[model samples]
Target: MTNLLQTERLIIRSWIPERDAEQAFVIYNDPEVTHFLGKSSRVTSIESQRQRLIEGIERMHQRNNGTGSWAIVEKESTTIVGTIILKQLPDKDGLPTQDYEVGWHLRRASWGKGYATEAGQVMLNYGFSVLNLPVIYAVVKPENHASIRVTQRLGMKPIGRTNKYYGIELLLFQLDAPVKIEESSS
Candidate 1:
C-alpha cells in the first residue's frame, strides 16, 4: 500500500527486496532468530530470500489492505533492523473469523533497543486508527519472553494459550481499540 509509518526512532515501510534482502536474510537465516518463528520460516540463501520477499511484496500489494508486513528501519543509522506485521490470522480449523495479528521480528543487533516496541506501537495506531479494526491480537510462543514483553509494552493483555491459530498452541494477547485514535500533526 506504500504506507510509510514513523515512530520517534524507527521507520516502517514497504519492502524493497533488492535493498532489504541481505539484512533480512541475516535475520531469517539465523537460528537464534528463527527458533521461535518455526522451522518452515527459515531462509536458506540470499537468493531464496530475495525471491521470497519479491513474492511477498507482490502478495502484499494484491491484498491492498493496510494489513501485511512492513520493514522496520532504524532512524539514525538508516538500516533495516526488522519487520512489523499486522495481518489476518490463519485459522487452525478452517473456520471463518475476524482475527488479525500484530507481531514484530528484530535482528539480533536490534534486540533490546526498544525498536520492536516502537514499531509495534506505531503499527497499532495504524491498525486501530487507520484501518478501524475493532481489536488486534498477538500470538507469541510461551517461551518467547522478549516478544511477550513487547506485547505488554504495547498494552496488550494476555488471553491465555490457545490452538485456535496457526494450528499450534500459543499464548494469546489482545487489545481493543480506544474510543478514538490519537490524532497526530505529523
Candidate 2:
C-alpha cells in the first residue's frame, strides 16, 4: 500500500510505528476532541498505543484489503494533526456490509481552519474513485455542529438518526456517487 496521499494542504498517510503511540495519546487524551466520543482515557504508554495501531492496521488489511485510518499531517510542517478513518460497520440486517464511513478528529489548535473539510474531501474521493464505493456515510453526534457542517460541505445529506456504539444518539449522513452528465454534440 502507498504510504502517503497528498491533498492541497494535507498529507493522508499510514501511521509509522514511531508516531503511532504519540498520535494515539493525543486523540485519547484530548477532552474537547473526545467529547462526542464519550471518554477521555488517555493512553498511558506509547508502546500500548503502538500495539493498538499495529492491530488496527492488521484489521484494516484483513478486512478492506489495505485501507483504514490514515494519519493526517500538515503538508508544510509534516506534523501529525489527527486521523481520518474509513471504518466498516455492520448493517441493520446483522450481515457484513461494505459501507465506507468517514470520521475525523484534530487538535484544538487545528479546529476552525477547514483542515477537516479539506482532508475529508480527499478521503471521500478516494472512497468513491479508488475504493469504488457507491456511498460514503458519516455518523456524528446530534450536537456536533462542527462535524455536521463538514459533512454538509462534502455533499452528504442527512439520511437518518440512530443510536451509536456507546448508546448515544447520532445523526447519519451519506454521499452517493455524483450523477454523470453527458454532453450532446449538435
Candidate 3:
C-alpha cells in the first residue's frame, strides 16, 4: 500500500488498522456528516466499523491496484481526519468505465477549513494524470451546499440529477479533460 499522498495541509494514504476504528467512529457517528448518506444514526460499534474499514481497504486493493478511499490524515499531527475515494463506476457493455467517481468526508473538527477542496484537487490530479481518466464525477444532495461548493471550486459542472446507489436524489457534477492552451504563430 502507498504510505502517503499529500496536499498542502493533508496526507492521503492507506488505512492503518490501529487508527481507523477511532476515526470511523468520529465520522460515521456524526449525524451531520452522515446526513445525506442515508444513515439515521451514528454507528456505535467500533469493532464492527473497524472490520468494515479493513474489508473496504482489501476490496479497494483488489479493485484499483492499490488506490481507493484513502485515510485523509492531518500533516502536522498525522491523525486520520477522514477519507477520500476515487473509484470507477461499472460499465454499460462489459467494458471498464472511464468516468470515475470522487467523494470525501471529514471529522467535524476538520470542517470549514477547505481540507475537502484541497484533498479533492489532489485526487483529481491523480485521477487524470496517474489513472489517465478522461473525466471524473461527483454526486451530492441538492441541499448539500458545502459539497456543491466544493465541486464548483474544482471546476466541475453539473451534468444532471440521478438516483444514487443509496436511493437518494443527487446532483451530478462532472470534470472533463483539462483545458489546453493554444499557441499563436506570428
Candidate 4:
C-alpha cells in the first residue's frame, strides 16, 4: 500500500482495520487515552472499531486530497503505533469547513517516543507542499499538555480558544506555510 507520508522511523498509511483492530483496540478502548477526545472517539467493541475504521477508509477516499485519517506504523517492527489525521474542521452543526486540521493519537506504550510529533510534522508538509494549504489548525483540549507540546514542536502558534468547531470549546493552534527563501544568482 502507498504511504501518505513517512518519517525517518515511521510510515503513515491507510488503515486496515481488520489487521489493525486489536492493537487499535488497545489504544482507543483505554479511558486514559480517550479522555481528551470526545465520547464518540471511543471504541466500545471490536465491531464498533471496525465501523469506525470503515468510516475512516471511506473518508480517506472521499477527500482525495491527502486529507483524512491514516495509520502510523513503526518502521523497526512494522507495528501500528497510532493514527494521524489531516481533516477539515467541522462546524458546530457538523458541516465541514474549509479549515483543515492536523491531529494524532498514539498508544500508551508509544507515548513520549515522539511519534505524534514526527507524524504531525510530515502531514504538515503534505498539507503545505502537496495540498498548498496556506495554514492548518489543530484543536486541543486545554488540559492536553502533551499534545500542546507536540503542537509547539510543530511550530504551531496558539490562536486562543474557539467554540466555532466540534461544538465544544478547544484551544486552537495554527501553523502557516513556511516562507520560501529564493536564492539570488551571483
- Residue-level lDDT of model 3, residues 24-113, one tens digit each, is 788888888888766643576888778778887788767865357888989889877888988865443434355578998888899998
Ten residues in sequence with the least summed lDDT for candidate 1: 89-98
- List model 2 lDDT by residue over 7-34, tens digit each: 8889888877665678666766677787
Error of 1 at 139 (Å): 0.2
Give the candidate order by descending TM-score: 4, 1, 3, 2
TM-score of 1: 0.92
Clashing pairs in 3: none
Query: lDDT of each prediction vs. the true structure?
Result: 0.89, 0.78, 0.80, 0.91
lDDT of 3 at 79: 79
Give each model's clash number: 0, 0, 0, 0
- Write the residue-wise lDDT of candidate 1 on 45-150 in tens digits: 9999999889988877887886788889888998889989998888887453589899998889889888888998989989988999999999999999999999
Top model number, lDDT: 4
Model 4: per-residue Cα lDDT over 53-84, one tens digit each: 88888877887777888889999999888999
Q: Backbone clash tally for model 2?
A: 0
How does model 2 fare in lDDT? 0.78
Model 2 TM-score relative to the real fold? 0.84
- All candidates' TM-scores? 0.92, 0.84, 0.85, 0.94
